[model samples]
Each structure stands twice: as structure tokens, then as C-alpha cells.
Target: MAALAREELALHKLHTAEHYVSKAGLRETTDQIMEAISGVKAAVDNMTLRVDRIVENQAKLRTTRS
Candidate 1:
């Protein structure tokens, strides 16, 4: 029947649209996760830099005292 065929076509189109929307949402979530990881990496790098400076200063003090 023509009516049944038309209904099936509509449902197929709706299903396809839903698939694309879900894919886009997944991409957005992945991007947010990557951004958060980047932020944590930056923070860790800053701490490492500070610790290096502290160690260097201590080494210099030890040499001066000797």
C-alpha cells in the first residue's frame, strides 16, 4: 500500500536524523574531555617548573656554603 510505504519512509528519515544527532553529541563530549585533560596537564607542568627552581636554588646555596 502507498500509505504504508510513506509511513516507512518517514520513520526511516527520523531514525537517520537521530543517528547524526547522537554522533554530534558524542563528539562534543569527547572535545570537552580533551579540554579538561589539557587543563590538568598545564597545571602539572607549572608545578614541575616551580619544583625545579626550588631545587636549583638549594643546590646553589650548598655550593656557596662549601
Candidate 2:
């Protein structure tokens, strides 16, 4: 499930980045550039949450074993 979610999120990021780039005027459009940065921030956030879940599961397994 996590793998699938990660793949989907990755795809979304790719599409979003492309869309931002296509709209951003070269040497201009600071606002669009900032928006692109925000998009990347969101992607990072999504990946971080996924990693946190994986770490939590590992901790639970360790406790269960001991």
C-alpha cells in the first residue's frame, strides 16, 4: 500500500513540476517560481509522512518481538 501511494505521489509531483515550468516565464514570474517551490514542499511533506509511518511500524515490530 505504501509503495503504491509513493508511486502515485511521485507521479503527481512530476506532473505538477512540469505544469509549473511550462507556465513560469524565463527570467520572470517570481510568483510562479514561488508556487513551484511550494509544490516541491508539499511533495517533500508527503514523502516525509510516508517515511514516518515506515519508521513507526519498525518500532512497533521491535517492541512486539521483545
Candidate 3:
């Protein structure tokens, strides 16, 4: 009857709210993971540049000695 309909409506609303909350949590986690990946990429780029400079300097020293 009417009481049963009301209960069903309430349950539907609760499920909808839970779904949104779960989606929001997943979005936040994805954002955090992307930020971490960006930070690691920046660090790797910095290390590569430093290594290249070191190698170039060593080559110059070898040429001067010869």
C-alpha cells in the first residue's frame, strides 16, 4: 500500500546517495594518483639532465688532457 511505497522510495534515495558518494571517493583517489605520477616524472627528468651534464664534462676533460 502507501506505506510500502514510501519505504521503497526511501530505499531508492539512500542507494542513489551512496552511489554518488562512492563516485566522489573514486575521483579523489584518481586525482591523487595522477599527482604522484607527475611528481615522479619531474624527478626522473631532473636526474637525466644532471647525468647528461656530468657525462659532457667528463668528455671535455678527456679531450683537454689528450
In TM-score terms, which candidate is top?
A: 1
In model 2, state the lDDT of residue 2.
100
Regions of model 2 farther than 4 Å from truth:
1-28
For candidate 2, the per-residue lDDT at 9 reads 100
Poorest 10 consecutive residues by lDDT, candidate 2: 19-28
Clashing pairs in 3: none
1-66 per-residue lDDT for model 2 (tens digits)? 999999999999999888766534654678778899999999999999999999999999999999
Better of 1 and 2 by TM-score: 1
TM-score of 2: 0.56
lDDT of 1 by residue, 4-33 (tens): 999999999999887766768889999999
lDDT of 2: 0.90
Off by over 4 Å in 3: 1-21
Models sorted by TM-score, best on top: 1, 3, 2
Model 2, position 26, has a per-residue lDDT of 57
Total clashes in model 1, counting residue pairs 3 or more apart in sequence or in different chains? 0
